[model samples]
Structure formats: C-alpha cells, structure tokens
Target: MYRNNKSNLKLMRLLPRIGVICCIALLLTAAGCSRVEKAEKDDKILIGLSLDSIVVERWQRELEILVATVNELDAEIDVQIANESIDKQTEQIQYLIDKNVDVLIVVPNDANAFYDVLSEAERSGIDVIAYDRLIMHPDVDLYVSFDNVEIGRGISQRLIDELKKKTVNIPEEEIKPFKLLIINGDPKDNNSKLLNEGIYASLQEYIDAGFVTVVDEAWANEWREKIAKDLVEKYLSSGEEIDGIIAANDVLATGAIEILSKWRKAGEVLVVSQDAELSACQRIVEKTQLATAYKPIYDLASTTAKIAVSMAKGEKIIANDSIYNGYDNIPYLKLDAYVVDLDNMDNVIVKSGFHRKEDIYRNINNGK
Candidate 1:
C-alpha cells in the first residue's frame, strides 16, 4: 500500500506538467495555422489573362500595358499565350479555372470554341472578360475592345479614298473598276466577321456604282503571314490584275505586301490593313502600305485592367452599351479607333509615343 501510494503521488505530480506541455503544443499549432490562413486571406488579387497569341507586335505592346496597369492597381496577373490554337486556348482556360483566379480575361483564338470551358469558369464563380475579341458565350461578364466595325469602315474608306486619288485625273465614266483583293482574318474570330460586315457595308455604294470589283477574297487561316503570302502569290501568279488589297490586319498586310514586293508592285498596288503595328507603320511611310486602323492600345488595356480589378472585388461596373452573344446580352465597353497614314502618322502614332519616329522611318531616306 505504501508503494502504491508513492507511485500514485509521482503520477499525479507529473500529470500537470504533461498537461502544460500538451497545452503549449496546441497553442503553437493553432498560431501556425492562423498565420497561414491570414497569409492566404491577404494574398493579392490574381488576374488570369489568357491571350490568343502574342505573335503580333501590337499584342506584345498590349501585354506590357496590361501587366503595368494590373501591377499599378495592386493586383497580380498570370498570362498564358495560346499561339492561336482553339484547343490550346480552351485547355489554358481550364487551367486558369482550376487555379481559381479572381478574374479571367481571354483574347479568344476562336470566339465560339470556349462555350463549355467558359461555362465551367462561371460555374466556378470566376468572372470572365472577353478581351479584344468577343467570346461567343453568353456567360461572359464583359466585352472590352475597340469598335471593330468602325475599324473596318475606316480602313475600307481609306482604300476607297486612295483609289479615288489615283484616278482623279481620269473621267469617272472612262475609269475601269479598281480590282481589289480581300485577305480577311481568321474566320473563326467573331471580330473578323464584324469587320467584313463593315467592309462590305462601306464598299456597297462603290460596288453599286461599278467603281470597285472584288477580284478574289479569302480568309487566311490563323492569320498566318505565310498563308496570306501564299494567297496573294497564287492570285498574282494567275496573271490577274489586282489594283488594291484590303488586308484585315497588319500581319496579313505584311504577307500581302511581301508578294507584292516580289512582283515589284509593292507601292504600285494600294494596300490597307488594321492594327498599327510598327512594321505596318513603316510600310505606310514607305508607301508600300497605304494606311492602318489604330486602336489605342494603352487606353484599351488600362480600361480592361481597371474593370477586371473591379470585377474581382465584386464592384459594380458601369457600361453604356451591351452586345448580344447569341444567348444573352453582355456589357460592352468600346473605345475609338483612328486611321494611321503618312499624313497623320506623326500626330497620332509618333506623338502618342506608340512608336519611335526613328524606327518607323529607318528605311526611308531623310526620314520622309
């Protein structure tokens, strides 16, 4: 009984110390978990930007401006380039969705290809913004880009105006209808169809008047420069007389211009395209390309970033316009576009600091 009593006393004495040790360990573990939770709660807002492709120079500029704007707004951006592949873009979007991004911005390679994935994103509670190109899905929260129809109108009008200038001295009745070649962008892109609508609308009056004839027109696959080059080459090789070309964007314009150059007809054939890429601007100054439709990228990118941040924070977005995406109306915020040619290139492009004057005029004598 004495031994049993002694052992009981010893165990009793050690019980409080073991309890204290356990209490201390529990407190430490709780503190570690709290720290982790707090860190996660304080993480910066993450914006997932899925781009169709950065193959074009303008897209690089837009990316730089978007990153800068997002950083300025105290948010983090994750960019994924799809290289103009619909399947790849869809997969990238899924990855972003799995990452649980606060906001998802997509410059879709194919407007209609993301219906299922975008639906998945919405189901996951992620806000989707169709950047530059409209995603055909109705679940898209916002569509931010320039007025694409106006861009088409502006570039087409420029083509018509240039043709008018070339035949000014000749009588209207005696002048033959100018032969025009239309090299449109990827058919899968919604913007391309909208652009064609505007192009045909702008050219209707001229076409009715028998002033312009579309000799050959085709949609370039993936907006590939080589595809555009091949299209123009094939047309020229058939001995067809092409007086003007309406290239959908600068990349296509570059391809078309290359074929024209090979035929020693670069400046002789009037060509107009969209997206004021640096190379396109240089071509304009060199008289190889007549004009380009310049969408103010800084304004577009900054506005998109701000809207995206606002959407991420559950803030209300005020948009004056909305567009129907085949199912529902989506908030549309459009910016203006400008026509950039030699006459106003200095004022619009160089003055805006979009490109350096020296770089645009590098190939020209006396920087004319």
Candidate 2:
C-alpha cells in the first residue's frame, strides 16, 4: 500500500505537464493547416481577358496565342469578346471583376468609355493591362503594342514609292498631280490618330512640292468595311480622278478596293494597306494592293501572355519604353512595323513563318 501511494503521487505530478504539451501541439497543427491552405490558393491564378472584338483576324490570332501561353504557364483564363460594343464590353468587365480574377487584360473598343469600370477593377485589387489598344485610364498598369507612328510612315512611304514607279509610263507634261484619298480609322481609337499623323508626316514633303494632291480625308467608323466602302464610293462617283489611296488597315483597304475594283484590276489605282492579314496577302500577290504593313502577331501575342502571367505573380517586368496616356507615362512595350511587298514578301513574311508559303502564293502562277 505504501509503494502504491508513492507511484500515484508521481503520476499526478506529470499529468499537468502532459496536458500542457497536448494543448501546444494542437495549436501548432491548426496554424500549419492554415498555411497549407494559403499555399494551395496561391498555386492557381485566374486571368480574365475582355477583348473588344475577335472579328478581326489579328484579335483571333491573339486569342489563340494567349490561350496557349496561359495554359503553358499552368494558369486558367476566361475569354470574353464584346463585338466592339462599349456597353457589352463594360458588362463583361464587371462580370470578370465579380468572379475575382487575379489579372484583367483588355483591348478596348472605345478608350474613353472604360474609365469608370477600370476604376472599379482597381478598387477590387485586380491589375489591368491594356493590350494593343491603350486604355486611356490612370488605373491601367501596362500597355503592349506595335509602334503606330512607324506603321503609318511605313505604309505611306511604300505607297508613295509605288506611285512614283507607276508614273514612269506617263509623259512629264501629261502626268498631272497624283490625287490621293485618305481613309482614316475610327476616330475614337488613339492608334488611328497616331497612324494618321505618321501618314501625313511621311507625305508632307510631297504635298509641299505639289507632287501629291489630297482629294479628301474621311474616317471609317469602327473600321467597318461597309462604312469605308460608302465613303470611298462617294468620292469615286464625285468625278474627281483618284490615282492612289492611303487606307488605314486591311479592312478599310478592302472596302476601298470594292469601289475601285474596275480600276484596280486594270492596274490604274494603287492602294496601300496594313495588318498583313491573309486576305491582304492574297491581294498583294494578285497585284490588287500595293503593300501591307506587317506587325508580327505571334511576337505581340506571346509577349503579352508572358507579361500578363508575370504581372499576376507579382514579378518584375522590363519595359523598353513609356508613353504618356493622358495622365502619366505608362510602361509600354512597343514593337516595330515592317512594310511587306512582292519584292521581299518571301524573305520577311514567308521565311519568317508568319504565313505559310502556300497560302500567300495560292493565287500566283509560280511559287516564286
């Protein structure tokens, strides 16, 4: 009985220490579980892409490239196209915000219309990247696109050179001042304004010397082909003899060509185009258009994808240049644009794998 009493006293003394150790272990386990859950949440990121329109081939290609890149980085993306409708685009942006996306990439149809919604995105702690088209808001974090000024200069210079070449057949006395019609892009788009400025800059010397006459200048609403066609048709039927056209893009170029089809097929009118779209490439091959400005879509898309992924993960990004977007100098990644014509089309467009050789040469009798 004395030994049993002594053993009981020792057991009683250790019980409190045992209880204290168990309590500490339980608290530590709960903390560890909370950390694990947080790590899991950080592993998956959702990116929301609110595009203005996938109607253009360039946007469609961008969509594919972005999706592929996001998938490669093990991130999830939800894509929404607004069909160039500002109201629809705004609603889509709100929907993405409600879903709590980590990052938002936008190609706005109308730059001025995004101020309110983008402010909401900023309040929600979601970063916004202006893709291709600069969103003229202070809240936008980044802008990625080709150099619009250079593109405009490229297309205009090439068209001017081709017109000079075509004039060799005309006798100096018979060659009247070349009448050029200017078809500008949507006025709401900042890029279009820059492009127009560049085009005029390139032609300033020619205009001063009376080598070129500007018959008329018109803006294509939303860059719609029908609107562009109507504008060009009005001028074509106005009795002023037009010798060349400076179209803002492939879509606008196509619109003008529909009106100038009879003259273009006869090699009378020269048209300058942009976007390097497949249709434009075909037109170049067929000799219907003079040249198309080529901005490699792959590089733009892949870079955007990588940038979006990095920005979402809070990684540092290196921007080569910056552009002032109404308020501040926004970090920008601006690429250059090249003019593509039949002379070096094989070297730049085909060999670079921008377009398959077979596709560009489909209408040409010989592959070369």
Candidate 3:
C-alpha cells in the first residue's frame, strides 16, 4: 500500500510536466507541418540531373550554374555523375525517380538506347529534359544542346585554314601529302557521328586532290582519352608516316600527342582537335599540338542551366536553330565555337579564363 501510494504521488507530479511537454511537442509538430506546407506552396522545385560524365570541362561548369540557380530560387537539386556508363546512368535515373523529383535532366549515355526506361519514368509524371545530347524518344519533353554539325564543320574548317598556313603553295606541282589520323568519339553518340560526318565532308576536297589520306581512323570506346591513346599507339606501331591527327576532342588530342611524341620522323606532327582544354592550350603554346576548337563551354553550360531551371519553373525555351536528328529536323539551342591556335590561344581561351597565359607558356621551346 505504501509503495502504491508513492507511485501515485510521483505520477501526479509528472502529470503537469508531461502535459506541458506533450503540448509543446504537438505545437512544434504543427509548426513544422505549416512550414512544409508553406514551402510547398511557394513553388520550390527539386530537380534531378543525371549526367553522362565529366569527360570534358563543360559538364562541371553546367553543374555549377544549375546548383547556383537552384539555390537562388530557394530550390534543391540532386546531381549524379555516371562516368560514361549506361548501367550507372540507369541506376541514377531510377534513384531520381524514387525521390519524386519535379524535373529530370539527363544527358543520356546513348540517346537512342533509353526509350523504354524513359517511357516508364514519364508514366510516373516526371518532366524529362534531354540535355546536351538529344534523347530521340517521342515522349521527351525538352531538348537542349549546341549545333553539333556546325561545331564539327567549324573545327574542320579551322583545320583547313591551318593547313593552308602550313602549305607551301605551288601552282600545279604535287604538294607534300598530309596524311590524317581521324579519331572520333563513341560510335553510339549521334552527336559524334554528326561531327565525324562534318569532318569528312570538310576534308572531301582535300581527299579528292590526294592531299590527305586517312591513314588510320579510330572510335573512342566511351569518349575517353585512354582508348584514343591505345588506338594511336596501334597506329604508330603500324609504321604509317602520319602527318596530322584529327581527334574529336581535347582528351583524344592529348592521347594522340602522347603517341606522336614517340614519332620516328624529325619535326612535330601536326594535330587538330576540339574542346580547347587548358592542357590542349598548353600543348598548342609548346607546338606539340597544332589547333583546337574552343567550343564556348561557358555559353552552353550556362544556357543549359538556365533552360533547365526555366523548364522547372515552367517557362518558355523555344530553340532558335534546327539540327537533323537522323530523320527529323530537331530544334537546337545553337551556340558558336572558335578555333584556338597559338596566335589566338590567348585571345580566345585565356581571355575567357578557360586557360591561363602563364600556365600555357610554362614549358615551351623544348623546355622539358
């Protein structure tokens, strides 16, 4: 009876304290609910962007722009890097789907290969924005990227200009032939295919005149430089007197330079490529490589970010240009690119802050 009485007294004392705590907890929970409801009402969207990979510098810049923009709007974004693999890309997209994001921005691993999964995702009410590379599925909501054919044509024409500079003009005498080693990006990427076609088209006149011959051509397995290195090495081992290399991007150009440095001939073999990366600019300064197409990474990345955010906010993004997506004339957010040589390397790349003048001239004139 004594123990029972003491327990009852303690319970009575705790009753008021317990009630206060319970009331406070209930108040806090209600407040949290109200805040959440308000936030939801204010249109703060959550976006999930799954990128193929950061093989080039542009992807990182795009991520920065997107992150900054979302923060400005009091929104959130989830970014995933697939490192250029379809399986990883699929997994990332699935995770985004599970999160119930307001928008899905994807630069598909293979634009044509993800139709089934994208359809499934669409069924769940996800707004899909095909980024950089066009996702060919009929259900894709938005498409954004630079003019791939124009990019290709620009680079090749720049190379032709460079060749003209190096050429010893003769009225009718046969010129010292310049053999080319063409290295394109992944065969599955439609953009890469278009770019290669442009390159070939630009070189057709030279090819017909017997001024250039593609000694060896290669396709990067996954738009990677290592594959390019392997292919370039194989070509070198074949004992072909390669005069110039036409790699599709800066990474491939770096890979080709690695193999070209071991050439059996006398002077540096001319190399041409795209994506004026810092290293590529440095190479140009040293004369180890000839030229690169400085695709305005800033413009594309910034524009993609703005378009993505606009899509999330339900804004207009009508494209100004059109590109042939195999059968259909697909619209595009076309941006311009420039060719970077030693002459304009500073003006084009360094001035844009893509590269530094000091770093580019770190080791020139055989200053190992």
Candidate 2 lDDT by residue in tens digits, 158-203 = 8889778867888877767888988999988889988999999999
Which stretches in model 1 have alpha-carbon errors above 4 Å? 1-41, 366-368
Ranking by lDDT: 1, 2, 3
User: What's the lDDT for residue 205 in model 1?
Assistant: 97
Q: Return the TM-score for candidate 2, rounded to 2 decimals.
A: 0.87
Highest-lDDT candidate: 1
Tell me the whole-model lDDT of each prediction, alpha carbons only.
0.86, 0.83, 0.73
Rank list by TM-score: 1, 2, 3
- Give one digit per residue, the lDDT tens place, for model 3 in 1-368: 11244335435544565576556557678566665455345545678889898767767776787777767767788999998889888888999988867678888889787777777666666667777777877556666766666667767776667666666566546566677778898887777887888898888888888777777788887887888778777867887667777888888888778877766331267777887777888888877887888877667765666665665555555577665554455556667677778889878887888866777787874433
Q: Please identify model 3 stretches exceeding 4 Å from their true place.
A: 1-37, 40-43, 169-171, 264-267, 324-330, 364-368
Off by over 4 Å in 2: 1-42, 167-175, 263-266, 366-368
What's the lDDT of the predicted structure labeled candidate 2? 0.83
Residues 1-368, candidate 1, lDDT per residue (tens digit)? 11244335435544565576556557678566665445444567889999999988889989999999999998999999998878898899999988878789999988888899998876766778899888888678889988888889889999899899988799777999989988888998889988998899899899999999998788987887787798789888988888889999998999899999999999999999898999999999988999999888999999999999987766776476888888888888988999999999999999999889998998988565
Per candidate, the number of residue pairs that clash is 0, 0, 0
Which candidate number has the best TM-score? 1
TM-score, per-candidate, Cα-based: 0.87, 0.87, 0.82
Instruction: State candidate 3's TM-score.
Output: 0.82
Question: Distance (Å) between predicted and true CA of 157, model 1?
Answer: 0.6
